[model samples]
Target: MVQDALAGAGYPQHVLVACSGGPDSLALAAVAAYFARRGHVDGRPVTVGAVIVDHQLQPGSAAVAAATARTLKDLGLAPVQVRTVEVAAAGMGPEAAAREARHTALEAAADEAGAAVILLGHTLDDQAEQVLLGLARGSGTRSLAGMRPSRGRLLRPFLGLRREDTLEICRVEGLDPWHDPSNTDPAYARSRTRVEVLPLLEEKLGPGVAESLARTAAILQLDADYLEEVANATFERLREPAGGGHARNDRTGIEQAGKGISLPEAALRDLAPAVRFRVIAKAAAAVGGQQPSYQRLLAAEALLRRHGSAGPVELPGSVSVYRLSLAQLEAEGQSAAAGVPREGARCGKLVFRPQRPSRK
Candidate 1:
């Protein structure tokens, strides 16, 4: 399975494993080392390396990183790096902040080594826990989809394997993996999910509940992927055509700094709610705004049906959407929103632009 994943990814010349000396990551490192040294990936010569991120959150994190690096070297992996990162408690909380910092460090390591592929060691158990957490938050379909096997430069070959499989592999390799106490620490939500909630769920709901959750995530991932594709295509199709506006559409750079994208109010009003919300979210993104919440999207939609109400439907990331009549644009000499109206057209245009700064 591990070899197949590398082959499917085209086996980039430089492959780095994000190892943390845990059983799962250690097992992954072992397989990756064998593939690089003994296996063939599209007959390409591959260099397998390891990166251990010391978050410095727990005491002795540096020591753990050093030991992990040494182990990888002994396992015949080349270019092992121990990158230390500061884990500040950002608004997303400690886990998310540490995750962000760790990824940044890994990215830096990959860049320094010119690696195009980075392997992660998340297993089916982790996927189950992630799904449960997503469920608790009443998240959208994308959130419920959980982690994918391949995300850009990151790949997880063990998503099909159970946690016990990695543990068994560690024993077979005669490797004593460092069990991070944080895994069982109740202070963390994931730890509690893994040690307590999952077991209780198993006792009450019977065995295979974790497996069921993972399967649900896999199914939802399929749905989410399809919706995103349809949404993007629909977004491009429904938006006002780019020409006829006064500005040369430099939408990619400086022009994008303030000017917003446009959608026809009539076109958006015709779409189903699911596709419409996704399209609205894409418009917000195009205007340098973050994903609007469901409520925000609803507010933006309400403006679509409202007449004679010139609204700057406010969204996050300093973005605002407006409903504009051709007359309104003509009076203000405003560039046609997104695109110019058809000659003698009656419909209004929806524009998304950056918010104006208040004067002191």
Candidate 2:
């Protein structure tokens, strides 16, 4: 499993394992060390290192980070580094903030270590839990897809392995693993899901439930990937020409992107609902808008005359979308109702623009 991941990554010169003193990450570190001793990967010379991030959330996080780094070094992994990060809520939950902080620390460490790829140790159980969380939130297909195997410079070789597999690895390797108290703390949603929800589910659904969810995620990933490619291409094609051209100097650059960007209403109306929704989201993102939630996307779709025309549908990131009215169409020299199509003609256009800030 590990070899496949390394080979797929093109056998980079250096790899950095993000360890957290947990059984999963420790098991990954051991495997990395085993590979490093070979002195080469896929006929290419390679080195392995470790980065232990201390979120400082618990009382002895620094001590745990130190111990993890020591263990990795003992495994013959070189240049072990400990990163301390400050996790701020930043309008998100503490867990999310901590994850953001952890990634930032890992990326900086990877750059400093000159590592080409950073390995994460998210097991199949974690992927199952992620899918469950996505389901609970009523998330879209992409969210239901769960965590990916490899994203850019990060790889998760352990995702195909179970949590028990990691535990057995630790036992056989005689490696002591820290059991995080947060894993059982009811104050956290993930803890509650892991402790209460999953066990109850297993009792009724059998042992294969987690594996089934993981498999489902793998399948959905393929579908989501293809649809995303289609949506990306469609978004580009459906956009109206800005300033008689699509060039940046056409006065429709990123800064002015949120100002009066238009998409053909008919083209959007013609698309499948799934593809259309994704296309709308892609456009919003092009104008620097945050990804709209599923509900927000539905609300945006409502303006296709499928629902009542509520003016100025506000998407996230201060962008608003609205279907053009007949008067507005006439103002733009578009004559659809008159049955005369001329240059720059269309039945209608959905305009996305920066919403004027409301007074406090």
Candidate 3:
């Protein structure tokens, strides 16, 4: 299955396996090395290498990383490299920080090795856990889509396999997998989800909840792909060009004038809620504004639906969205309620302006 995934992704030349000495990664390293030595994946010759990233978040991490690299070399994986990365606890917490650091290290190692793809060992169980977390957080469809088999240079070939299968592979190959203590620690949400939540779900849901969740993720992924395509097309149609240009002949009355994009109140009101909100979000992002939250999007939509209501809807990153007419843009020094102009604008344009930081 791993070999098939790599081939299907058109990454058959050189691949880097992200090994953490865990059962999943060890199995991946063994399988990948075996295929590379056999001289073909999908009838094409391949070279396999391994990278072990030590986050140094725990005691004896250097020794663990070194041991993992040695095991990879013994498994017939050439060019085994050990990279030590510093994990800073950002706002997203230690797990996310470590993940970001690990990916950075793996990408650097892959580039150094001239590898076409970086293979990860995320299994079906991990995908199920991710979907469940997304559900718990009430995140939208994109979050529930779970991990993709191929995302840019990162590939997860084992996503279709169960966690037990990797453990079995390790046992049959006589690979001593290093069990990371963090895997069982309750401090991390993923650890708690894996050790406690999944088991309880299996007990109550009658044994296949994980499989069902994985299937749900696959279906949601398809839906998300289609929706994104539609959203992108709609955004393009609704967006006013950066420079002054005639708007499309659509009834939406979108206009581009002097560095601002504008949509008529009637144009937005006629759109499906999904397409409308997506276009609004895309418009905000195109103007160097931060992606707004669901609430912010809703507020912007409400402003558009209302007639003759001038709003200075404040968004993240000090960006603000306004609903002003062409007459208002021509005026000078409008009142606070009418919104202060930060840059050039023409009437009927929904302007996204980032507030300039005050000089110290």
* TM-scores for candidates 1 onward, in order: 0.89, 0.90, 0.87
lDDT, candidates in the order shown: 0.83, 0.82, 0.78
Clashes of each: 1, 0, 1
lDDT of 2 by residue, 139-170 (tens): 99999999999999999999999999999999
Highest lDDT model number: 1
Return the top candidate by TM-score. 2
Q: What's the lDDT of the predicted structure labeled candidate 1?
A: 0.83
lDDT ranking of the models? 1, 2, 3
Stretches off by above 4 angstroms in model 1 are 240-258, 325-327, 333-347
Of models 1 and 3, which has the larger TM-score?
Answer: 1
Ten-residue stretch with the least lDDT total in model 3: 247-256
Better of 1 and 2 by lDDT: 1
- The best-first sequence of candidates by TM-score reads 2, 1, 3
Clashing pairs in 2: none
Q: For residues 129-204, write the lDDT of model 3, one tens digit per residue.
A: 9999998887888889999988888999899899999999999999999999999999888999999999999998
